[model samples]
Target chain A: MSELLSAEIQNCIEGPVVKYGYLSEQIDVVATPQSGLTSSTTGNRVMTDTISEAQNPKSFLLAIEALERGL
Target chain B: MILGLFVGESFAELSVAESTPSSRGTLREHQRWYLPKHGLKAYLQNWLTKTPHKPERVIVSSRFLYKLAGHRLGGSVAQIVTSGFENWSHFASLPANTRSTSLRQLNRCPSLSSQDLIFAVHERILSDGSIGKPLDLSEIGAIHEKLQVLGLKKVCLHFHNSNLNSIHQQQTRDFLVTLGYEIFEPPVVDAFPSLEPFTRWKTNTLSAAVSGTFEESMKEIFEGLSAQIKEEQIFFFDGDLRLHQGEPLYRLSSLFALEACLYSQLSKIMNTKMKSEKPLTFLHFGIEHFSYLTDEKTLTESPWGTLALGTQGCRDFSIQPSSLLDLHDDGSLVTKGNLSYEPGPIHLGRGHKPLVADLLIQETKWPEIIDLDEKQARTSLDRWVLLMQTWQRSVKKLRFLANLLSVCFEIK
Candidate 1:
């Protein structure tokens, strides 16, 4: 398994590098659990909704005040 | 070194899997959503999971595709001005034949045509007094056949507007039902009592204050806000809305609102005397485009107070918050979420100009200094234009990807 893995890495490194410039040559790839990746999509959705309210001048002022309260 | 080895092994496996006929066939179909000539899929499917009986393909209308390609609804009037047209009158006075000839010449130069300025102007005029054509029944049938071949027994069809009020949309929905495909209709919720009045008042008041017509932009913004307010109200009123309807009360609304609604509804179920025998599956459509749930630290720093409302409401309902969806922007999709990747902050790059310094320089004794200031201003303006163009292109690409992904998901 170790030999096979090393050969795979060697093959990848030997392939043509296109966009990443120098980093492509020096790149190290790692695999981790799926949970390691963090996503902010949910937070942004909420922010979009909250900001939508700010379209109104009254809501705009309130939004500013709300922001000042820091969350 | 071990990590790199593991990654290489994984990549090899991925390549083998992707090279399979099934994967290649799907890729071919997906490429239709992007520039056909490029043969690239509009969206990265890194985060997509194929589940049976769910939507496998989302077909966006040509109208949206035009917009994604940087053709605005009102044409490139703003762009025309930036390209040195003094005003609307100046653009209008240029003979149509001459303008067309010049546009054709400009098209020959790839750099000048990169923005699709000529196509936008032509499309605007052509689509005047008419909405762009809708997808026909034949197109829908073709997509259905493709999904059927892929062994998808049923697929969910979604339109951006759930009302299905448009003649074309209604006809499409009717045709799909005839073909025995289950249509996923987003639940209708009542708007908050204050929503309409508030939106109307704001629009009317702001229209007067602003110089040009603000109604168009403000109207769209208010309509969206009204829809969100309705979703929130439904979440507050209907505890069993998701379960009863077989869908979340709000699917495409704001992430914060969706989380709050889900948490509240789930809490009600948890606290009830009667227990549900089976686990409830909540469908969060188009959630991957939104921000992830706010972390405790970030929540406190957020300017939107409604975020707090969502957090507090969840707590009150005894719902423990969880990361519901992964954050995948267009750049992240391309990079595959590289740890070292940091998007350049477009907003922060806009530096402030000092009016006081400019005034002083203009009144100064040194004429050469004034010339220097003018040169600097011109340079800054050029830079600003370039940045704006880049930002607009990025935004259009991201929007296109998001729309494509939302329209279609794979069935595994």
Candidate 2:
């Protein structure tokens, strides 16, 4: 198969990130894997209990998933 | 770049995905508590200077408070003053039918006029004390001519205290219909005139207050203004419906505060070149409910300081840190093992980054309000930049600490 990881990883953690978990042919279920920056909207602002606070984390998850799926 | 003024909470309805009355109240509270400390206007101004694609002119409009705030942020960046008569007293207190010639003349003070700046403060005065009198076509004609003389391509009108009725003033909404001015309004607050409750202690300065009102008034004002002017000549910047709620709120971030300073510094780097290119456009990126919890650990270590006294997980995520809402066990924030820090990729969203262009619009009235030629404008800009730098330096340290904590948590 092609390389599972590439420069697109730069969108995440700034340094080396090694994935640890059992890799199946269909899905790569990994344990807690470390990447550059744990992408979260929390880094952007101190969200109160408002909808805006939840938005970043939700969107961040989607973004990470998209990147990982493509990779 | 033409400056576009989005006074008050103009874009909130569009920007925010959804909002409740209480949620909106929290938003306004957050704005008052954090906006000026963030130095939003200065930040946007600096960004305008560095942006590769900028308008040659700018329109700086806002609520009365925003106008005052802009004045507080003096710079070569031009401003256009537009709003209702509530606080026009700050500029000039006049009776009905007083030709703006004198007011415009007053704006000509060396302290007021700057390079290529135009000032158009339109007040709707009816013969009686009621609202919605047709804009004296003569005044509209004069304002229109002034804009034309300045060679302005677009005008962003920050409609403050205008409500829906202000739109009918210019020949029953003729002026705005004709000029095609871009209109913007801030998010709506629960209370129409929030002034009643907080009479004792005003949370925001004049500039911040004005910005909010300006947003509300734009649509009606421009609708009226456009009706009287050339329709094709103007464009309204209502702002993205989804992002509007958060745009003003985002100004509170230490990152955004620092961005303003950086932009200003960058402007100095290219000051000579700035004149040759088109005028710079300042885009204000406001975020909604900037206060939120990442994980419990991250919530404690954030730069936003204590919002209330409670474990974040137990409290409502929508609550802002103000007297109105009591989400905490005590009035203070709990810091035991607090782990909040700079928004990580996980926090910010994987690929969710803000776009610069879509959030900005062209305006052409900034130069006049700042009185570019005078030392006061420059002085004000300097002070604003200085304050932002200080805040940035402070947040930068917090970011470092937060990152360290994030690493520690990851290992654990």
Candidate 3:
């Protein structure tokens, strides 16, 4: 099967991608996934809920501290 | 007679068409300049009175179309939340695409409420449908006075645990309404009551911020055409392009960049340049180039944050408004993400700056809008590019088919 995909997107897909000219088969192409990046929406560093709380405080007073301290 | 009243940023047009069993017959359209001071309703009322046949139903797409088109709410909106959750909207529920994303570059996406306007009043509802803290009715007068002084009429209330216990929100809403204020209904709070608080808060607040403007615009269009058609007969479209009857929009944020929704729909039916046997991704190239989403994602599933929220899902998209600069030395194009709309008549020879259209279409041919000098447009662009080139170190020039899409990257 043929796929008209961007090289940027193709760099991210993990599985083997085959490029064929209409009916021609056996043209095997492997998609090498981009290094140092997860395919999932969530990143490698999943901050805990408490950390998120520090990141976005409920109180404006807490936010002042969150900003200076680099929450 | 079936009619469509389209209210745009600059002008409003009323289109009358005869709908047939098989085809849409010829359309007799009348264009009217949108003059807010004179009142849209009166203009519409005058126009409708002149029509030979009574208008059965009019689909009036209001001035909110401008806000939706450019993701800019007309007026400032104030948001009231549970005392603790003052910065609730700052925590959008959008997912992170990559680890490498720099926080500096990661913009705090389309915020509806002004930071100064977000008021945290004394009110709290526990998750168990219990009122932890009752509504502080005392806070109402001061808030109302502040609103009045600022000329800010619209207010959105989002209390913590509002889903389980809406007493505080209702009380606040009532209190705010008594003060001659336009209280906006929280987004999706009625329908999706169990949404995660962060997502819920962001969604509700964004809608709250834009809803007042949306309502006002709708009111202008509807009131103008109210003499001709019933309120129920008036129709509007969500971002998914699904026709909905009357207001209290399903997902207001989805309506941002409404034309992108149309483009999303068009991408589905429009034949692609590259025909492939397997699943294929589509890329659209025009004056301003854009890559369309995957096929499955194109279908109208959930259009909540389609345009407004600058969510970097799997991809982060940017917009460059009018005026493309040239990397003259390399014969490449360069532009920054202005994301501006109909960037004020520059190409029409009104604005001081020179737009891309001015460079290409000027003198060569007279466009839809006239009164332009091509030579001057090129000179202005050349001067602007020279000014920008001195500071901007990195520039990306993309060649697609024959056209060059020059995009300048922000390096911090």
Candidate 4:
């Protein structure tokens, strides 16, 4: 894992920053167009999944569509 | 040459004119690009590369598109909350039997952002609104670099007692601004200037959730346009095509309000019975679907509850705020898996789908344009009518059965 991501999870410890909740993290990092999706932060207890690099995040496209529905 | 780059939900058009509108004609050549099944950024880059025009002046009539798509096309707003309260948004809406008054029905919704996307920043503002613990800038810098690599540049920040002190959020905002992140500063509602911390955070969070994606998309577009066309004076259109200065807006709820205010008068919204069904995305035709990943919860998924922004935001669309003929396709038509549905130029009639507003930006078309597939339109309407009829019949039957059961179960 790169130092950048590690720093975030490292700071996410027992304090005012890290909340008391389930710690299930899944970050679909678009490493590159060709690299598709990689487990960039999976080792830091974060799971990584590969998705189509070309399309917007599934939910984002939906959100826009929903907001602009009709007009 | 004067150039017009018109962007819409599903199509983009670049029109160039060698002279003024009154002299001969303003449109020498025009080309429309349809969004292929993937990579909007790639598609836009390809579109710009293929356009063989060098524009000295450019006018953009995006209006509503930018506000709705505030983040990168597919990017989400990375949410940051002060420590220990990450789940405040995640679980704030459940009926509080602790309210001490009464309870009502509500949807068990997800927060604007998913847990994975939300990060915790170390900062604390005391109940008395004092800076109890100063913000940790190092942590923010690390997060910035991490997000930079992933091409995510928007942040929705909330700190403890932000409304009271607002110092931590302000400092964090200033820091993120320096780092080039499009921070959606939780707004101060015009009516409620001294808004409580929770209210302010909620307002800002909703805005970020909705408009964050377009931030990246517009940035890419601006960069793409600059690399392609060296136009110095560029003007962007507002909700009603009114030219405005400044960057794209992050407050989608306000933009929607403007659209509703202007177009609602013309739309047939009086018939509540007919408008109940949020007009099923015109049978999902021309709807863009990005449902490859399902498990990850999106901003539109839960906490905000399907296009609602609480008391401060636009009322839920279910109230039929706008036209009855609304074709807003909110992921209702995601093709089961991925289909080979490709969109191309509308004039050539290359595709079967009917993505509207292809030629809308052109002044010649004014408020009317885009070729709708007659066959697709008919099929979609037929299907919708059939679905509604079936739904109405079922509802009537259910109501009758309920009435009968109520009477039978009465203590006579």
Candidate 5:
């Protein structure tokens, strides 16, 4: 790693760390690209999953439709 | 009998319509139906007779029945139920054992907090008693501490805003690391991930041109460019243009002048290329974003959430024609209408008159018609241009590296 990146990482690690809720397992990798590619990919995947789930049988969409139809 | 009224698959066929004027008409039109005390119907044999175009079904769930009950019971009964009390006064007069059980039953019913409670109770009734309680901050800290003690190698710390710089956060990080936890800090990429470098370059160039006195700045920029690249060759100019510091009018005028300069330069380049043996080339330029700082006190309090700025500054400069005002300037801006008149020159900082005058300066050159010293102008332009070129090359490299990484990933 370059000296600049190394220094930045050190700063981040030694800097103030806010403790949130715990996770059961340790993360294997940490990817933080300077770009929005990862964020975009993750967002698209989530949206696709949500749409597919909504279209599935026994989904919330079905429940809402049944309620509307007085079923 | 009430259970029988609700029982069977056919019970779902019951259409409950509120006794509104529109629904009353529908009820009268569809004669073959039994209307309950709350104007509910057992069936509407030909409900679609009135509006054939709109075949919409209205479902009245159990919540409607609860609302109907509240309406019939009046305000006092509704208030008693909300206060977590038994509706009937006779319940208090019952035997001790009977009263105790009756009180327990009343308390077991969901408490009403708002009018929406009628509908909320339906969901509550359907759901199993397995709702999770919101986790407290103390509980979260304890869990994090436990994870650290377990010797977890990788952990993520998420916080909003300046909270990351707090002592508590620092202490937590230290505690985790001291316990042998390896906090995960992702590698940072050097270049902008979203916008193309050319877009960023053009924006910076335009911003610099409009940030100050146009002719002087441009002359300086071109002079600086003379050292690194020939004046005849196509080149890029880049520098920090602190455009927001001055008055809004001046800032806007600077932008207009820069636009005119760029258009002229682009036309010249295209004309030259047309005469030469070289293929046609295009120069793409755009500003991604721009921001300015203003005194917080200047913002007027708006009843409608949005804050307004007083138009007194613009009105003071109203001597200039309205045609000069930029698209951002509101033509219908109303003055605060204060009657007091001060002696000094009116504050034109808030107005578009400066911008209009500056735009005129682009063509007329009224103030200083003569251009700056060629050598001095060249020196300044050269430095800015070189800086811009260096940044552009760096951005290009970063883009290449990103593409290489993606290609490598594809191969893998």
Candidate 6:
């Protein structure tokens, strides 16, 4: 992860998170490039899935692990 | 060359004078649908988390999800609520035990409200329910106060309905302006969507029978209702453009038509209203699809919904096409006159056929004198060119990335 995306993910994790009424102490960051070739094909899709997975922490970690294998 | 933005789907087409190669270059380079489908969650999350900069005044036509947007946008959100006083079990899920009262029925509808930066649309009453009733000024005043408390920076009222002449519609406009709201009347066109991607099947023959400035009509309406609604608070927006919503396939076509009207109207509106500030692109929730995106899965699926095509912005079209203004595919500005539509070759496959209205802009610009006030015309043309260039560049960038990814995978 580049410094900027890593930072953004970190911020999403550390900052106050209130989405659909879920509260989290620590949120993991999954960084994806928006511009590169990898991104044009699948990056946005992966990121969307990750955010959704993070909706429930248990599934989020499992999804992240599964996603990493594809990468 | 005079640059006219023609917004409509397959039926309506724009024509531009073939003055310079740069003209074609400008149109080709600039054609884009600004709203991107991907990365909405990321984009919205980024927008909300950012520190509040300039507060936005938001107005919504529906009462569906003001709270969600309010929480996210963090400023104020206002609504111009409109409705027929009746049971709204379809829209508002009321408790079964609570015997529905007519007053409670009235409350179920959305009305016009404007916060500083955010403006809300008034719920549309298509039939006999809500038009012609004298609106309560207190209701208007109370809504304005709520908008103020919500940290609104500006207020604008947008109302759309089929009954253009009803007493209640007039009163709604009168009420909003009395509370210091900028009221605009958008141009209304009646057209239906196409079933096939590229082909447009004009089932009903449509025309712009009347073409007078809606702003002028609004002034008359406001003045007529002035006996009930106070006069001092109302401000009129000129050359407002709104399109009729019906049919499904005409989604892209109607979108362009609305865009064209908005483009022309905004140019006039900004010049007259703001004087100094230019109008930034305003992203509105698609009128028909307002209720669709709450479920994340739907966002990724098809971008279907009435909000995308069925907007009750202006109530002008009827089934038999009577008692309304008609318009033509030609670039002429007709008001309060009848327009007629004749069937054309449906050869253009759905999505692939170059949009009729978009093409018309190029064709229309081709013959007309692009010359206006030397500086103003140049500035307008330049802005159009810049917008086109930005879109072309964005699409090109996306396509390039897609191709590169394809190559990399093939190499592997």
lDDT of 5 at B116: 18
Misplaced by over 4 Å in model 2 are A1-71, B1-129, B132-134, B154-161, B168-174, B185-412
Candidate 3 lDDT over residue span B1-412, tens digit each:
4565555443344556544434443344434343432356787788778878565765444434333434534247777777878776555423222322311113323445467777778877787888777777888777777888888887777677777778888888888887777776544434333555766555555566556566776677677777767777766545444556545544363343233332332332233422433333322212222222333332121112322232112222232224343444454444322322244324433344444433443323323222235674565556555544552464454232122221111111
Question: Candidate 4, residues A1-71: lDDT per residue as tens digits?
Answer: 12222232232211111000001011122232222222234332212222221122112221222223321
Report clashes for each candidate as comma-separated counts.
16, 131, 3, 24, 16, 108
Q: Would you list the C-alpha lDDT of every candidate in the order shown?
A: 0.22, 0.25, 0.44, 0.39, 0.22, 0.25
Best prediction by TM-score: 3
lDDT of 6: 0.25
Please give, as one word, the docking class of candidate 4. incorrect
List model 1 lDDT by residue over B291-319, tens digit each. 12211211110111111111312111000
| Candidate 3 C-alpha lDDT tens digits along A1-71 | 01212233444333222111111111112222322212232332211111111111112111122122222
Please, what is the TM-score per model? 0.20, 0.25, 0.55, 0.41, 0.13, 0.24
Tell me the tens digit of each residue's lDDT in model 2 across B1-412.
1223333321111011112333321111101112222234443444434444332222222222212321322122222334342233223111111211121112212222232443445554343434533444565566667766665433323233433344523342356447754322222233233322111011111123233344444344344333232323222211111112223332212111212221232232234534543222111112221121111211111111211111211111111111011112332211121111111011112112111110110121222311233453454445444543554554443221122212212111
Error of 4 at B7 (Å): 5.4
The sequence of per-residue lDDT tens digits that candidate 5 reaches over residues B1-412 is 0000111101122222223334421221111111221122213222333322231222111111111211112111111111122222222212212211221122222221223111100011112223222213453345455544543343422211112133333444566567565432111112323322222221222222223333343343335333332333311111111122223223222222222222223333344645643221111111100011111112111111111122100001111111122121222222221111111011111221222222222233222221334563355445434543554554443221122122111111
- Badly placed stretches (over 4 Å) of model 1 are A1-71, B1-131, B158-165, B186-412
lDDT per residue, candidate 1, A29-50, as tens digits? 2221211212234421111111
Interface RMSD of each: 25.9, 20.9, 20.4, 23.4, 27.3, 25.1
Alpha carbon lDDT of residue B74, candidate 1?
17
What TM-score against the true chain A does chain A of each candidate get? 0.21, 0.21, 0.18, 0.23, 0.20, 0.21
User: Highest DockQ among the candidates is held by which one?
Assistant: 2
DockQ of each: 0.02, 0.03, 0.02, 0.01, 0.02, 0.01
lDDT at B242 for candidate 2? 13
lDDT for model 2 comes to: 0.25
